[model samples]
Target: MTAEEYQEDILDHMEHMEAETMPDVNSIDIQTEIQWFMRPYLLDFLVEAHAAFQLLPETLFLAVNLLDRYCSRRVVYKRHYQLVGCAALLIAAKYGDRKERVPTVRELKSMCCSLYDDEMFTQMEWHVLQTLNWVIGHPTVDSFLQIALSEVTYDAEVEHMAWYISEIALFHKEFVSVRPSVLARSALALARCVLSRSQARQSEWAGTYDPVVVLNLSNHLYQPSQVLSRKYASMHLSAVSTTVEEFLQRQAQIARRNITPPTPPALENQKPDADGYLTPSTPQKSHYDAVMQHGCLTPPITPDNEFGASNFAKNVLPRLYPVTPTSAPQEAPQQQPQQYSYQPYLQPRLAQ
Candidate 1:
C-alpha cells in the first residue's frame, strides 16, 4: 500500500482514537468545588505559557488535550488545577519537542511564581499518564487541519484565520466535546466565510459543516480572545486577526441593515402629544457609540511586531501576573500561590 493510498486508513484510525480519548465537557458538573467559569483563566495562563516557550503550535494543542482528558477522569483539587496544566505542557513538550526546548523544573516553578515544587509536577504528571493509560498520541485538531489544508490551495490568511478561530475555541466549554475533525472543518468553513473567500476555492477544502453549529460559533465570536488575536496579528501572519475583525464588523453592519428597525420619523415630522414635550426619537444612540463612530473603534496600526508570542514574557507577564512570593524557611524567593479561581489572573494577556 502506498502512503497516498493508505491515507484514508490513517485518518479513520485517528478518528476512532479521538472518540475514545476525547474529554467530556460535562465532566465539570461532577466537581464540587470548581465551576465552568474558572476554565478561561487557566486556559489564558496556558496560552501565555505556551507562547513564552516558543514551542510548536501542536504542542499547545496536545497539552490542552491532556489537561481536559485528565481533569475529566480525576477528582482534582482546586489547588492542583494550575499544576495539572503545567504538567500537561511539560508532558507535551517532552513528547514532541527538542529536549533543549523543553521547560525545566525550575523554569516551570518560576512561571508559576514558585507555587509548586518539582515533586508536585512529577506526581501530577504520573497521575495524568496513568489516568489516561499513557495514551498521549491521540491526534489533535491541528493534525486534522493539516490533512484538510493539504487538500486545498494554500492561503496564509486562511491558515492563520483558521488557527485563530480554533484557539478561540480552547477558551470556551462549547467546543470541548466537539470532534477534532468536526472542529477543524467548522473552523475552516467559518474562516472562509469571515475572509470572504467562500465563493472562491473553499468548497474544495472546507467540505461541509453543521450550519447551526457554524452559526453558533460565529455568533459566539462577537467577542474573541484578544490574546489569540494578537498571536495571529503579527506581520508574518498577514494580520489575519485584523482581517477577521474587519470581516465581523462588516457582518454586524449587514445584520443591522437587514433588521433595519423602523427608522423613527425625524423629530420634526412627529406630531407632538397634548402633553407638549417632543417625544424622543428612536432610542438615541449611546454617547459611547457616537464617539466610536468617529475613527476610535479601530486601533491605529503600529510597526508590525514580528511575533507577538515573544512579547508575552517581557511585557505581558508582568502585567498579567504580579508575583507575590511566600516566605520560605530557607533562602528561596517568596511565592504567592494563587487559588484555582485566581481572579487577578483573569485579565486577557497576549501580544500585538
Candidate 2:
C-alpha cells in the first residue's frame, strides 16, 4: 500500500465529509468567522492548483494545514488573507519538497487571477515565517509510517498494509484535520485496523476495527458539528463512523471534478516584476518545528524586538514608499498684545 494508493482512500473520505459537513456559506459571520471558510477555500484552491499544475498534493495539503493553524492562532486582517495563504503554500513547498521553487508572486497572481499584490504576498511570506520561527522540521507522514512499521510485528503483509493505509490516510485530510499529531494517530489507527482484522474471527475483527483516536481526531476536526448535532448526545468514539460517511461524499465530488473536462489558456512564463511594486523575493525559512514544540505565542516574529527584527523587516514589511514629508508650510508668528494696552473699567494703580 503505497502512499499514493492510501492517499486515494483518504481523499475519498475527505470528499464525503466536506459535502456533508461544510458549513453553509450564508450562515457564516463575515467579519468574525471568515477565517473558517477562508481556510477551506484556500485548501480547495490548492487542491485544484496542484492538479492543474501537476504539483504534489501532500505539499499543498500540509501547507494549507499550516496556514489554517497559523490563522487560528493569529489574527489575519482581511486584506492579508491572500498573502497569508500564499505564504503558507510557499513554506509548505520549501519544507515538504525542498527542491521545489517557491512560486513567484507573478506566477501565483496568475494562478489566483491577479487578486493579490506582489508586495503583500512577499510581506506575508516573511510574516508567516517569522511567526513560525523558521522551524519546518517535524515528523511528517513518512516518519509516522516508519515508526508504525518498527512497532508492528515484522511481517511483509503487515508492512504492506501499513504502507497502504498510511498513504491512503494522507489523501483523506479529515483524518488529519486537527493537526499533525492527530494525523499521526489516525494513520496508526488505520494501520492497526488493517493488521488486526482476521477473516475467520468476525466478531474479533469487528471489535478491533474501530479506530479510537481517529474519532477523537474527528471530534477535534468537527467540534462545531459534534457539539450542535441534535442526534448525538455527547459525541463519543462512534462519531468517526458517522462523520466518515460525510467525508467520503465530499471526496467523491473532488474526484468527479478532477475527472472533468479541461479548459485551456496559453501558458506564459511569468516575467518576475512587471509592476513597480517591490520585486518578489524567495521567502526565508522559519523554525516552525521549534515554535510548535515550545508552544509560545511570541515566536521570533512577535512585534517586540527580542528575535532579530532585521529579518522581519526584510521579509515581512510591505515595500516602503518614500514619504518626503511635505515641509509643513511655514506659519507666520502672531505678535502678543502688551499687558498695559487694554485698561479695565476699574484699573488699580500702584502707590509710589
Best by lDDT: 1
lDDT, candidate 1, 23-104, per-residue tens = 9877866987667788888888888888889888789889999999988888888888999999999999999988888998
Measured against the true structure, the TM-scores of the candidates, in listed sequence, are 0.71, 0.41
- In order, the Cα lDDT scores of the candidates are 0.78, 0.50
What is the TM-score (0 to 1) of candidate 1? 0.71
lDDT of 2 by residue, 240-261 (tens): 3344446556767898999997
Q: What is the C-alpha RMSD of each candidate to the true structure, in Å?
A: 37.3, 35.5
As a whole number from 0 to 100, the lDDT of residue 268 in candidate 2 is 86
Distance (Å) between predicted and true CA of 342, model 1?
A: 99
Question: Model 1: residues >4 Å from true position, as ranges?
Answer: 199-206, 261-352
Q: After best superposition, candidate 2 residue 49: deviation in angstroms? A: 2.5
Model 1, poorest ten-residue lDDT window?
Answer: 285-294
